[model samples]
Each structure stands twice: as structure tokens, then as C-alpha cells.
Target chain A: MNKIIFLLTAVIVAAIIFFVPPIKGLGELAKIIFFHVPTAWVAVVAFFSSAFFAAKFLRTKNFSFDELSARAAKLGFVFVLLSTVSGAIFSKLTWGAYWNWDPRQTTIFVLILIYGAYLTLRAAVTDEKVRAKVSAVYSLLSVLTVPFLVFVLPRMYFSLHPSPINSSGVEMDSEVVIVLIAAVIDATLIFVRLMRR
Target chain B: MKLFGSRCDCVLAIVRKDFLLNLRRRATFAAMMMFALTATASLSLSTGGALLDEKFLAAILWVVIFFAAGAGLAGTFDDEAQAGTLPTLKLYGDAQAILFGKMSVAFLSLVALSTFILPIFLILFDVGVEKIFLLLATVLLGLIGLAAAGTLTAALTTSAAVKGGLFPILLFPVTLPIFLPAIRLTEISFTPAQVDSSLLVVILAFDAILILASSILYDYL
Candidate 1:
């Protein structure tokens, strides 16, 4: 199972880098999405995973569920950091400034602040159960605003960031689409595999 | 249906109880109101009578409100936490009622502070209220988001050993989106121009989702 997962991720990733056409305007910079989008999508999915287990933990008062939530949030934070940096690179290419206060940029900053606080809250508590309880609550509550922070709030402004995925997602060529779909599924399987462990 | 009505009663009861307690002590209100005034006054002094542009004016007004919220809103659950009534209070209808009750008090208290501070802000800063009704609507909607997010954050942080400093740190970022539209609206309010109100819709929707989510998550805390 593990070998198949690794092989699948490897094949899809290689295809993304070598096969997809360099985007117009974005040029090679768009290649980062193969890296950037999956990390972010996983990060978001991981946070939701965290929140799901958090709700479960709260309902059952089970420590294991809390443990899963904490790991997922922590993993999400790493991808969040990577995506923000990659986004800054993209911004530098397109927006002139690496850190323009664009709506999407601001939303990324907000996400950092949020999970940063979540991690800090987790670390601050000495009691395991208390740590789990508080972190779980934060995770669940934070997810509620994630949609607003990422979607609604950004749209209220005229954003410089390319909103390739609006109510309608990007109209990509089939090859790029196939690669992306595979990458997302494979990345999530890593989490599925980890959870099983 | 009956059970839901009973839950509403419980929420109202908690709201009333908090209001009465807050009225008697007025500690948080005084603290926050004073903070708002001095923050406003201090900003005036710092600028040294230089004329602020419309953006700075809108921004600073909310800086006052945000810091003022920081001053007292963290205590939303502090009274119960400190009094050791938290465990006992959880025996009520649910965390939803308790959260609403706590949220209402915090919302009203901040609104009251805004009521007092807005006039003082106008006089001290020498800015006029261009769109009073629109401004009030913006402020009211902004407060709902601020208060709900604030109350939920307060509950999250009140458990920590290092809560005092962490409150604003957590609260600020979470409420960033809420702050954005209000500043934009305040800017529009200055000119009373016919700009889009899609921002207000975003903030209101966020507030509704936040309160509902907080109520759902409040159970764990």
C-alpha cells in the first residue's frame, strides 16, 4: 500500500512538472501550483480533518481523537507556511511587491495568525485533556471562518490574485486536470495512511 | 419546539444576568471606555494637530474600538471562570445558550462604548459623520462579528495559563476580515458615496457563521 502510494505521487508529480504547458503570463511560475495548490488544498483538508476529529473528541471525550486533531492542524500549518511563501513568489512575479496587501494575501496572513494561535494555545496548556479540549474548540471554530477568510472576504474587494476558481473553477486542459486530480487524491491518501497507523 | 424555546429562555436569562452584573460592576465597561477615550486622545496628541486623511481617520477610529474591545471583551467568560461557576454553569441548557448570553453582553457593552466614543471621536479628531445611518449599520454589523469572535476567543484563551497577553494576539487575527469591511465602509461613510455594500454582506455572513460555529464548538471548551 505504501509503495503504491509513493509511486503514484511520484508519477503524477513528474507529469505535472514535465508535461503541462507553461501558463501564459505566469510562465514557469505557474509550475509552482503543482507544488503550491496541493499543499494548500491538503492543508485545508487537513484542518477540516482536525476539526472533524475535534468535534468527535468533544462528543466522546476521547484523547485519541484530540491527538489526531492536533497532528492534522500542525501538518496544515506547515503547508500554510509553504503556500504563503510560494504565493509571495507568485506575487513578486505578478504584483510587483512580494507582500502586497491583496485580499488573498491578507487572507493567507489571517490563516497563519489563526493556526499559529491554535498551536500556541496547544503548547500553553500543561494538562493533556485541557490542551486537547481547547485546541479542539479552536480548530472547530477556526474552520467556520476559513470559508469567509478565503472566499467571501476576498471577493468583496477587487483582487489582483487570479481567482481561477470562482463559482466556476478553472477551465484547464485535460492533462493538467488529470495530474491535479491525481495529486490531490494521492496527498490525501498519505493522511489516510497516517491515520490508519 | 418546546425545548428550543426553553433554550432561548435560558440564553436570555444568561444575557440578563450578565447585563445586571456588568451594570453593577461596570468594571469592564469603564476600562474599555477609558481605553477608547485615551487611545483616541493619544492618537490626536501623537499626530500633533496634523490633519488626518479620510483613511487614517477611519482606521484610527476602529483602532480605538479594537483596542477597547481588547481591554474588556476578554473577560466575557472570566467572571465565570474565576468565580468557579464554570462547571456549575455548564449544567444549563447548553454551551449555545451560554455563548449567546455571553456574546450579547459583550456586544452591547462594546456598542455602548462605541455610543460614547463616537461622539468623542468626532469632536477630538474633528471628523464629521457623513453617512450616519449607513455608518451605524456598518458599525452594528461589525460589532456582531467582533463580539461573537471576541467571545469565542475569550473562552478559548481563558483556559490558558498565559491568557492576558494571548487574548488580543488570538482575537486580532481572527477578527481581521471583520475589521477590513468596517474600515472600508467608514471610508465610504466619510464621502457618503454610492459604493457597493457587498462588503457589509460579507461581514454579516461571517458574523452569522461565526456565532453558529462558536456555539457548536463552545461545548468543548
Candidate 2:
């Protein structure tokens, strides 16, 4: 039953992604948003869940919760990596550069660093209990700052990246929005399934 | 024995002990100053004494301070950990107090290091700041953010085998929010009307959140 649901969502998402008409003004490039935004969304969700489980571990001192947190973080890192790559490609196609130090670009770079450090810290520790405790604290710390990095810091500067929904009164096409939402829901469902496994 | 009664006293005592230890050793601060001096010299020589953009100069100054702090701040808890005194402190001292004390000492060391280096930096780079007050506030806030972030990171890295190396890796990424706004503020200090005053609040918020979270998580460390 679970495998069926996963497969069903996966196929449906693929269909929505490819079949959706090209967004106005962006053409084929608009498809990048489907892949990029949803991956980034999943990454954010994964990191939050990682922190949630880390807090649970801290409170309960349960090793399983630490394991879960670690799993979630690992997933988050992969998703963030995917998001970054897709965003870069999107930038290269639309903005004419693979890596412009745009505010959004810089923040994503920092997010990569934060989680990269988390993984390295995990690898450096030998004692099980110590590793769990330290990494849990580190994840919590990362989550504490992630908001400031992702949301607040970007706003501190002018950005050239296109945001899906923003305060500037720009509206995404309804068709594109549907595909993007479907993509996000699909990525999140996969994440949930992967976590359970 | 009595020093641990009140939180303020506990924090002060730890800061005092750390300061005394720092004075006797005198290595961390000296190393940091030496680093800043060498980096500034390299910058001047590399530029061939040419006048540079004030904003670029501002960025370079913060980079120097960031690296200098990285060079020194990792040892905030190193001495106690090496001497096997950490367990005692952990057992008897309030964890939050230890965190505050460690962060305070780190902030002070950074301030002293900056004071020694800032004049040299200004002289070597031939840059003028029209907003000394703004620069001062930015530097002070940057130092607090560094100390708060570094203290917690230092505590975490104490048990690692390769401590110094892992310190910067853990420290730099987590402190990005602090660094981004700090460098921008420093740039604005160089040219007052270039940016808004809102980033000042961001730095303050970063310090507050990190300190609060560190205080809560210190017990685990």
C-alpha cells in the first residue's frame, strides 16, 4: 500500500511537471521552479523536522530520537544540495550566471555550510552519547539561526531572484502555481516515506 | 566556594579565572594581534599602497577580525578541558554562568585585539571613517555576535581530537547571519548614507537569540 502511494505520487508529479504549459515570460526555464522551489521547501521542512526530533532527544535522552534527527538532517542536506544545483542552473539560464552573489544565492550558500558542518561534526565524534548530544545541540542551533539567514537576512539587501509569492505584488501564473504546489507536496510526501523507512 | 552562590558572581568568577589564565599565558591575544598585523601588512603590500574603495576596505577589515577571532577564540574552554577542570566546573558552576563568562572573556579579547589592530588597519589602508560612532557600534555588535557564537562552538569542540581545525568550520557557517549584517554595517559606517539602520537590529537579534539558545543548551555541553 505504501509503495503504491509513493509510486502514484511520483508518477503524478512527473506528469504535472512535464505536462504543465510553460510559464509566461520564462518558457522552458519556468520548469526549473517546479524542481527548485519544491526541493528547497523540502529542505526547509526536513531541517525543521530534524530540529524537532533533536529537541525531542534533548528532552527525553532517547537515542532513537537522535537517530531520527540525524536521518532527517541527512535528508535535508541532500534536498538542499538539489535545490542549490537547480537554482544555479536556473540562474545560468535566466540570469546568465551560474553563481551570482545574489542575496538568495548567498543565504543558500550559508545554509549549505551550516548543514555541511553538521555532517562533519557527526563524522568527527567517536562516542555515541557524546555525538548524539553534541549534534542535537548543533542542529537546534542551526534551526535557531536558519530563519534569520533564510528570511530576514535576504530582506536586508535587494535581490534579483524571482520569488514565487512576495510582497511586491508580483503574481505567479495560476497554472505554474498549481504545478509548483503539486511538486512541493510530492517532494514532502517522498520525504515522509523516506523518513519512515 | 561562595562564588557560586549567585549567578552574577559565578559568571564573574569564571571570567576572572579565565582572564588570569589568559594573562599568565598571554598567547591567544598576542597571536590574534600578530595575525591582524600580518594580515594588514599583506593587504597593504598586495595593494602596493594604493587607495582602495572604503566599502571594500570595510569588508577586508571584518574578514581580518573574523579570522583573528577564529585563531584565538577556539581556546575559550581549551585550558580547562585540557587540565581536567571542566568536569568540576560543569558539576559545581551554573552552566549558563559558564557560558556568559566564556562569552564575556571572548568578547573582551576580541575588543582588545580590535583596538590594537584598527589603528594599524586605518593607517595602512589610508581609509577614513566619517561615522566613528556607527563603526564603533557595528564593531561592538560584531564582537558580541562573534563571542556568543564562538563560545558555544568552542564548548562543543572541546572534546574533539582535532579541535583547532574543526573550530572554524563549525564557527563560520553558524555565524554567517552575524557576518553578513556586520560587514554591511561596517560598510555603511565607511559611507553613512549608503544603507539603512535596520541591520543594527539584526545583529542585536542574532546575539540575543544565540546567547539565549546557548544558555539553554550549555548544560548539555
Candidate 3:
């Protein structure tokens, strides 16, 4: 919990850096890198955690693991919602629109809906074991599309979002490279802290 | 010979019992059909028939199919729950068989409902026969995926504290990928000259995978 607070504080401090005067407009796009990207990264982490716990629940037929999996899925859904909203806001500022139906936007929206269903499924079923097993199978099945939706499909199709600097097959300017790396590290630290709780 | 005869009789008895119950409660089917017709008609009217455009029409058709399927699958276990017969059914028959049987009936009903709506959609939207066939085929494949996924999730959530809104919420997202390909195929089918073979293959692959997973995991549910 303390670690989570510390990480969250770091996020706030990062936000302050972007929001405070001197660095505002030109840096606002970079601000999105901090919160929006982390939300997506954490959502992915939460999904994997849910899957892991789901598998464990099925293997051992343990209710605790089932509960853990359900909780992780719930968290994942929240992060997915956050990611979508933040990404939309960022898109509006950078691209002059809130909703573009870009491949990234569309695919992530679908993913969010999928995870939303995952939580709803847990809430609907009364029998604990049946819920766990069924949800486990679903979580696994849904994960199969994540790779395609997040990576392959988006790139194969048209998207307004910038391709990741490393993967776009283009050289990155020194400052942009530094900011991107910092953003990733900061997001990872936040995720690690959240997971500890 | 005597043992096999008894087992066969038992399976038939169970199926017959389920069928009779379904037939007697025509309310469920009637309500679903009415819902589909009303929703489709309202959509067709509200759009001033602009929804007749293949792209817009396909989207509306899919939305209707989705909700109709939800309405049908939502009640799949309701009768069992109301009659308190699920435990009895679970004990007397293979749970897998029961689930598959229910799904098969629901899928058929959805197909029938789609049959009614498809013609109306094509007529209202001015879609060609070729596009209609493509839309119908895509809807069928998509329904199979929906029914399979929906049945399992519905069964899981049937006993939950709040089953009403929860079922659709749970079913929709898991079925979104299936929806995309269905939409794509409908669009492609509208323009037969530009049909992508690979997209069709992907939809087929998705349907097979979801069906297999749903079937394998359904018994546990």
C-alpha cells in the first residue's frame, strides 16, 4: 500500500511537471504519455493477473483463487475504461477530435467492452466453481485477440496514433527517446506497486 | 439390448420433456420475435430508410441480431431455475447434452428470427440478393459464436444476484471480435468484386475456435 501511494505520488509529480506553466502547451502531449500509457500498461498487467489466477483456480478448484481472478478482472476493466477515456482526450488535443474511429481507438474500445463482460459474467453467476471455470476459459480465449488487436491489426490498418518509436522503423530524436523511456519506466514502477497490493 | 434401450429412452424422454415445456411457454419465443420485429421496424423508420445503405444497414442488422440473441439466450436457464429443475436435470442427463440442446434450440430460433428480419432489411434498405446471402451467412456464423459464448456466460450468471442487465453486459464484449468480422463480411459481401478471401477464412476460424472453447468449457459451467 505504501509503495502504491509512492508510485501514485510520482505520477502526480509527473503531471505537475507538465501542467505547471513554462512547460504547458508544447508538453501537454507528453503529459498523455504519463497517464494514458500507464493506464493501458496496467490494464494489460491486470488482465494477465486475472488469467493467471483463473488458471490457478481451475487447477486447484480454489475459491480464493477464483475471487482473486474476479478482482483482477474488475481492476482490469477499470483501467481499460480509464485508458480509453484518457486516450480519447489525448486524441482530441493532438488530432482535433475526441473520437476518430482509428484502429487503436476502435480496438481498445472493443477490448474494454470484452473485459467489462468478464466482470459482468462473474457478477451474474451464483455458483462459485462454475463461474471460475467458465470465466477462466473466457479470459484465456479473449487474451488470444489482444495481441492481434493491440499490435498486428492496428498496424496492418490505418491509424492516427503514432507508431511506437522503436517499432516504426524510424529514428527517434534524443529528447523524444528520453521522454518515451522515462514514461515506460514510470508506468512499470506504478504497475509493480499496484500489483503488490 | 435392454440396457441400451433404457438409456436411449431416457435421453429421448429428457428431450421430449424439454421440448414440451418450450412449446407450452410460447410466450418466450413470441416476445423475442415481437421484440426483433418492433426494433427492426423502428430502426428502419427512424433512419428515413438511410439505413438502407449497405454499411449502415449491416450495423443495424447486427445490433438487432445481438439483442435478439441476448433476449433468447437470457431465458435459456430461466425455466429450469423457476421450476427448480436444474439440479434434477444435471443429475439425470449429461450437463453437456443439456447445454448443447438448449443452445441448438436457441440458435435455430435466432436463425428463424433472422430469416424474418433479413428480408425486411433487404427490402427496406434496397440490398441485392448477393449481399443478402452474404449478410445471412455472416449473421448465421456470428449467431453460432454468440449462442455458444452467450449460453456459457448466461449459465454462469443465471444464479447471480442481478441477472437481468448482467447477462447482456457479460455476453457483448466477449462477442465483439466475432461482431467485427461479421460486419466486415457483410460489407465485403455487398461489394462481391472486392471480397477478401482471407477475411472469410478469419471469420470461419474465429467461429470454430469460439464454438470449440464454449463447448469444452460449458460442461463445467
lDDT of 2 by residue, B116-135 (tens): 99989988888778789888
| Top-lDDT structure, candidate number | 2
lDDT of 1 at B219: 67
lDDT of 3 by residue, A1-197 (tens): 56665775675566447533322343545466556777787788888888888778777888888777777777778888888998988888778898978988887787787787787666666676666776886777676566557654664457878655556565545554455556656666655565556
Sort all candidates by TM-score, best to worst. 2, 1, 3
Better of 1 and 3 by TM-score: 1
* TM-score, predicted candidate 2 vs. hidden true structure: 0.93
Question: Candidate 1 on A1-197: residue-level lDDT in tens?
Answer: 89989999889878977888876667877777676677777777877888899889999998999888888878878878988988888888877888878877777777778779888888878888778888888777777667677677766667898766567767666777778788778877876777666
Off by over 4 Å in 2: A13-18, A166-170, B1-5, B192-195
Q: What share of the true interface contacts does each candidate keep?
A: 0.62, 0.54, 0.54
Using Cα atoms, each model's DockQ against the true complex is: 0.50, 0.65, 0.47
Model 3 residue B16 distance off true place after TM-score fit, in angstroms: 4.9
**Per-residue accuracy of model 2 over A1-197 as CA lDDT, tens digit each:** 47866776777667666667777777866587778988888988888898999999999999999999999989999999999999999898887889978888887787788788888888888889888999999988887777786678668777889865668664876766766777788788888988999
Q: Between candidates 1 and 3, which one is better according to DockQ?
A: 1
After best superposition, candidate 1 residue A71: deviation in angstroms?
A: 0.7
Question: Which ranges of candidate 3 are over 4 A from the true structure?
Answer: A1-28, A121-141, A151-157, A165-171, B1-17
